[model samples]
Target: MQDKKLSELAATIADPARHDPGDAPISISAGLADWMLAQKLSLAFTSYQTGQLIVAGVGPDLRLSFNQQQYARATGLCYDRGRLIVASMFQIWRLENMLRPGHYANNAFDMALVPRTAHTVGYLDTHELSVDTAGQIIFVNSRYSCLATIDDVHSFRPVWQPKFISALAPEDRCHLNGLAMDGGRPRFVTLAGISDEKDGWRAIRQRGGAVIDVASDEVVVSGLTMPHSPRVHDGALWLLDSGRGQIVRVDPANGKQDDVAFCPGFLRGLAFHGNWAIVTVSLAREDKFRELAIQEGLEERGLAAKCGVLIIDTRTGNVDHSILLGGKFTEMFDVALLPGVRNPMTIGPATVDMIGAVTIGNPAP
Candidate 1:
């Protein structure tokens, strides 16, 4: 079937109107398509602002091929093996790549993700999810200020939480928001503050963030400015100091932080590809950080916040490339790299026809 016909069929089976692409204007940096081709990777990101999941890759003609699908309050994204996991408003979705190695769709497309499963976990305010060493899904449960996983019997299973939080409640006491994994286990996390009271993190949003060692239950790094997205890479602990719009590398042993890169906007999602670090930035929400340190940082640097992705060279702490978004989308939550995939597309649950169009099974020898 033709692509247009397939899309129309899918829409007919599902909610056709919900899948309409909005009028947002997206601009890719010069040579970004070529860069993606040379790097052998595609990009996936979530925009909670617009409730969308977006993928960008290089096509066979060396041009950018971008796709967007609607998912309610899409936030955290994870790409493991051939599966893509995404956290939305009240559910977790698992999407599997259906294309076999070296296979193509219509002799042109290379990656096709099909939504296969969804687990309703209520509204836990999920963020920064990853599959652990034991192949379990773990995510930052922001609503309850803890790290949690899907539970068959309950809404969620708490794996870990900040020591300062006395109990698990939907109050968002300290705004615990980032999780870092090591050896397939939750190791570190970032929070907006140390308060144990409801919405207390707001009082210290300017300079009270901290990175805590989960196992030791100790604050490894403190006095940060609304830190988020703690990640372990290249033998160092990296985090985004969102209130300062800077990427910081921390010495795990000594608790020292080195400025890796200063980006424009409020940084959130973080990932590493080879020598490059990928970080997502959003136009700072005035109500959220208007009077916070992030606003001051922007003024000091004579820069305005942006909504997009920055590809920074880790070694030199410089932004090598960027993809900028304008129009309807403003805030982004997470980003994941799709290695070795090109011209990627997804068949969402909203597209019933596309959902039944592909399948996989083992063949008899």
Candidate 2:
């Protein structure tokens, strides 16, 4: 059923005629592959069932390594002050370069800032993390209304919080999905599936989803379907509008959007290596990844989807290389170039983290 339909889509979608630019032997030549492997880091999980993050080198062999301890479904990761910050709804874990195998420190910080008085000012569905030159982390969410921040990862200090619209009495469900830093300043942010500012629900009256510059608390693009995962690449604000199944770029000046690439199904997780974008796609059609298993002829063989990492050429809208993943895995929230690894790293299964409203150093009134 669902799986069969997915396969049909894949059959039509996959263009085998598309080949890698340089078929350099997987193990041969010193180029991007060599650099990726030479500096590869293994952010893998100890237990496959509950692995936190896995690090691997390039080459089909995919050699793996780990730092022990499950960070509980790490959704987004960012390199800050020479450390890898892992984002999760339940907790924000920082893997310092000096972290040992079993070292653990609780209460990174606590504060009286979170309004609920019920839960930590953490994310309900944290998706992305961005750090400013000042070392502050800006995080986003899937359902929570406010974009939150931790001035110090070790302390619970709320620098910026989403201003709730009291008139609307919103449900706190409008999700903030991705974050992109504008001009090295934390104030500008791009959003996906923006909920209604009033009710924290999708305001059908407003444009679907959009790119927002939190500094001004203004929507950058209106009428988007379900855009997700954004980053600044090659001097432009590149974004993924998952709803229209297109990769788009927005003009920082006017917020006009133009399609750069289009893929079927839902696409999430985007990172860049030079000019190539490493992306993760979830083959499932209807929210749950399991639905992909029932798509049609897919039920029997099950799909080891070609939906892993896609190395995309932004200028030409061409996919350079694709790292496929096993279908047994559901969805990948975010993917990044392994700090030290050559291939790339993807944190799988949907996950979340605490976010701070974009910090506009000096926003126009």
Candidate 3:
């Protein structure tokens, strides 16, 4: 109905462990090389239950009715020439039947095609997708401890292989998730239950979550609780701190962090349209944090909560709009606004293919 007054929300960092984890050097492992290669996992964006519709939080009264049968669970979303191109955690798919004009069909699955990778190399399940200068698509393969880009959509092959941060160590390993393109360069943040060093120095640095700039290869922000996906919005870097159920905006020039919004439940995905920021929210499950709680066992306890997308206006710091989906049947991985091309999607090869077009860039700004 209206934006939550900032005064009503207490801006307090209750968990000290989540504040900072000084520069504690981690040890390198002997098996970093092999560990990096063996990092793939079963990733589904989970868009279905009964009816084939993948529900999305678009506006206060508007919910995107998509054909789930046409896609897996999409984790990241972006636009390619007005058409909605979603990153289904494990693969990429185009929405054919659901992208229609004013058509709300509560239906279920459609056929999908897995893009063929280079040399028959298996597709290294990836999360987010960002376009590069020549239309090359940059993606994060959660399984493989590295970042890669494919020049063509039809031929899923990586043209560039950036050196991984783990490669620096005898055995380096890190969970590369939530990638954002900063100033046209690949910058990423990481999330790990363990350490990335190979020398058995599992420095437990994460109180909540952390992110990094891949190009600079530096950990710009740290001490967060389960911060998964991040984006640069309104000239500032914004991220979803899932553990705390809040959205944070950090200014790169001076490292000034501001709390823009919060979702008490499971808030993961984040995106922006004009001056408004959209976050995918889900109900929080305390059982998932059992091991971490026992390990650190901090005195100040954080509350476990529910899930939904919370939209906020950066200019006025007001939530002028929002879309609340029923938690029982609604679990969204990512959200994207389709521009020009109406639904009923299909993907083959972009005329100005994003996979190789170096001119294309990130959605952040």
Candidate 4:
């Protein structure tokens, strides 16, 4: 994460059919508008590189509407029960939708996520997070190489860690980056390496990536390249083999990874909307991602790497739509889906009346 001029950074992001994106260009693929309209859903994503929480949805005119909210290094997003859990630089913010079923904001949006609570946890380089069936937030504490939850009297409560990790130290020994929940429980996790020392993943980040079972601490699959985003979709385990620019399904029993789709950039965050798998893609960072298979794969197809989101049809491995970023933002961390929500917006910490807009509990008769 070295400092670079915008001009120099722009060289990495691809110019895929620019669409006058604010502070950048967004290339929307054909039929994406129609597909979004039919699905009745919206997207919420984050970019720690640019420190923003962005929401994208189809408008009534069949075009896309993007709303970006400011946050300090926003990394992970979790949308459940009409609430969004946003992980940022220093704290985890819990936001709730204020609009009711028939209500719309500004005569267009049906959902507005307003920050309701903030848990100060310092900076543990937290990555992906999710809420279980019982409404508890579980997140990957990458810097500490463990899974943790918010504490009432302390910074965080360590819940689990890789068995290979001898101690719960803030060493980032394995770059654990993803947590996948099954049946509302943390079932699988992704790590860049299996090292047990300080920042040890850097040495093997290229080929030592692995997915581990949360319950058994057994390695489900290994020998990957910067693997990330373990997700449970359609009763299957899917993840991003980032260095190879591929989305793959893992066979837990045989330790096999089956390629589901090949994206054009370094894939990171992944979420599914019905049958479509939505993934975040970014150009390879030289120091960390030099010589990755993704660069060659994209070059072979006459494609350049991009920083944005891709909507892929998992059934056929075809990209249904793409939203490429070209300005200050060069990487995205995570994304989440908002079912039955269109044109989602957000209220920031300084916004007037954002704190006043509250939903009270029902009164007993």
Candidate 5:
């Protein structure tokens, strides 16, 4: 059986010895290792529930290599060139891959991401992030309902906000969460509501979700179900309707949306790797939340909500691989795919190795 094969592979490929005893048990698809190897891809994800940033990749023996570092309320993650940027509780960390090509650490890891600098962005509840052509970091400031950039003296510099928002405040009116970049500039954003009042998005959390065009300040798409992670991929717009547990593509012209693939769990993070769309799936929160349509879909399908990574082929809507997480880890916020990076590791601030290793300039290129 397919399920049996996946579990068997997880028994061998998960490398339980490397994981902490208190950490969650991970189950990965049997073909995921081979598939990632073929594509030369690795995965980086954040678990807000567990406060950790994890990197998953393949090694020379073609086995899965999992490394993790603790970051308070780790959420949004991005990998640009040789730099890995991640959003945490009160700081945005810019990590650089320390190894050059043909270099390995301990004759194993090909890439070593070390924290080089951090931007104190306050408790703004930052979400998705992207680097523009000008090499500037643009992040979703959810609490302020705007896209913001890091500031030297201020908490964050507001770059853009929805037209409906009258002013920037910490009221979390629209709950702006996703940022879509096009031509190296932020082009679209996904929000839970178009409300301008304090916590107004909670009144219409189910069907009030919408997508706004950054340049034109127009609501290009509306009537979505808790939409998250708006993405520009292959000349098309893709996003997750989290309440419905489905990935939808928007036409942008008439606000028409077509279903692509429906995966278990409430979808959040999305990253494109060649023709494959890597997504983060999470179990819906029980407290301070209403029952969503995703629960009904899962019930009808006799499937439980999953917390892990999913790979969907954009062209045919086929779910190629899935990694499920259980135990202490039950939710994930975002994922970043490291292209051509194998057996990657991240150095946390508490680690002695980070204190010992010193490097100037860029780390990985």
Candidate 6:
């Protein structure tokens, strides 16, 4: 993608309504808070359609609490080492959790994330962020059709590219969108197609998707429909077959796929907490997936695409809880599990509250 086109796309999504809480009303399941508390996990997700990063958890009062911070076209999200990494349109942001264990804010918040760093990557169409064991931020550089990391003197440093891709360019040939880590290293990835020409993935959006083993440089599974978020948990390789609205687990050895759960909306973001898989669902945009096979599957099942997070039990393939969004926030991009946090809050650059917030390190300890 050209820089001019990227700038224009960014400008088009700059909506002020994303900063207003009232513009997006959320309706969560009755037992959602209890389910989160039982799992001892807090949820964080990015809504690119609304340009907001949302965090949700249960407060000490046993009620569901949520906080929203605006980031332009927020898409990929990663939480590790008490820091939250978010990928926006033109930059990757790192927000540090400022609260210590057992520390509380206003006697409620246990986690307070404040923006600490921002790396401007010049809109490489970043997606599916992860922190490797070496503390490097690895992300899918979709535009270049490669895996990349932050560079001090350049837009981004290419770490690995598919063998079929001959060169690093902004062609977006295959639409690579998901990355999975094994033993803290890049293990597998999912892409819409295996083409090496500009925008070639669009031709096979229905059944040309595949999952590639990064180490072997081989396509392990194929014939998927817009698969995203290849996650490995409990000795299983799981991914969201987005075009079919199904979560399928694949055997890395033989490339066997098993249907785990069927969701109502277009699935994207995926995270695992214990035996539950937290998946993000988005209402399909007419311009994007109007005639996709997933749309036909929804209609056949008499289901409507919804925008929310579905908590699915991997053991039984059942949706145990959900957090539904209405009004302006109709789509989401990624979800992360924030462990050891009861109630979380964040400060955005647009808010006055961020300016007044200050923290001092121990002096000359």
* Model 2 vs truth, CA RMSD: 13.6
- From the highest lDDT down, the ranking of the candidates is 6, 5, 1, 4, 2, 3
Best by TM-score: 6
Per-residue lDDT over 1-365 for candidate 6, one digit per residue giving the tens place of the 0 to 100 score: 77798666756556566344465678888888887887788999988877889999888789999989888889999999889999998899999877766788878899999998899998788999899999999999999999999999899999888898988988999999999989999999999999999999999877899999999898888999999999999888999999988999987667788999889888999999888899999987865656677777777889888899999998898988999999877788999999878789999967898898788766895
Distance from true position, residue 117, model 2, in Å? Answer: 24
Write model 4 residue lDDT over 179-283, tens digit each, in one string. 999999999999999999999998988789999999999988888999999987876788999989999987665766789898888888999877889999986
Residue-level lDDT tens digits of model 3 in 1-365: 01242221111112222212233222222432232123211011232211112332222222222223333333555554433445542355433322234433222112121222322122344566666666566766554545666534342544222343434222324455567776665666555423554422124523635677666656677877666677876678888766555678899888788877655455666767667676665543435534333212222434334334455677766555444445243345665543322222222322232243222234787
Better of 1 and 5 by TM-score: 1
Model 1 over residues 1-365: C-alpha lDDT tens digits?
24674454445336634533377777778988888888889999988867789898887788888788878778899899888999987789999878878888767779888888898897777888999988899999998999999988788999998878899998888988888888988989999999999899989877899999999999999999889999999899999999888899998878888988888888899999988999999986657667767777777889888898899998998888898888877888899999878778887677675647666678878
Order of candidate numbers by TM-score, starting with the best:
6, 1, 5, 4, 2, 3
> After best superposition, candidate 6 residue 162: deviation in angstroms?
0.5
Model 6 ranges with Cα > 4 A deviation: 2-4, 12-21, 287-290
Question: How do the predictions measure up, each by TM-score?
Answer: 0.91, 0.63, 0.59, 0.90, 0.91, 0.96
Q: Candidate 4, which segments miss by more than 4 Å at Cα?
A: 1-22, 286-288, 353-365
Where model 3 places Cα greater than 4 Å from the true spot, the runs are 1-67, 94-123, 151-173, 197-205, 289-304, 315-318, 327-330, 340-365
Q: How much lDDT does candidate 6 score? A: 0.89
lDDT, candidate 5, 1-365, per-residue tens? 14574454344324433333275689989889999888887899998777789999887788888988877678899899988999987789999988877989878899999998999887787899999999899999998999999989999989998888999988889889999999999999999988999989989987999989999998888888789999988778999999899899887656678998888888999999888889988877773223688877887889877899999997898889988888877789999999888689999866788788786665677
Task: List runs of model 5 lying over 4 Å from the truth.
Answer: 1-21, 287-290, 360-365
Candidate 6: clashing pairs of residues: none
- For model 5, the run of ten residues with the poorest summed lDDT: 12-21
For model 3, what is the alpha-carbon lDDT of residue 265?
53
lDDT tens digits, residues 1-365, model 2? Answer: 14574454344325322221122211222243544555443222111112235444443454321122234445776654445666653556655432223332221211111111112334345567777776666666444445556633442343343443322222444556777776666554445445445334445312456666667777667666566777777767777766555688878777777888755445677777666666766565445434221233233445333344566777798766554444244355666554543332332222231233112334678
> Which of the predicted structures, 4 or 5, would earn the higher TM-score when compared with the native?
5
Per-residue error (Å), model 1, residue 155: 1.1
What C-alpha lDDT values do all the predictions have?
0.85, 0.50, 0.46, 0.84, 0.86, 0.89
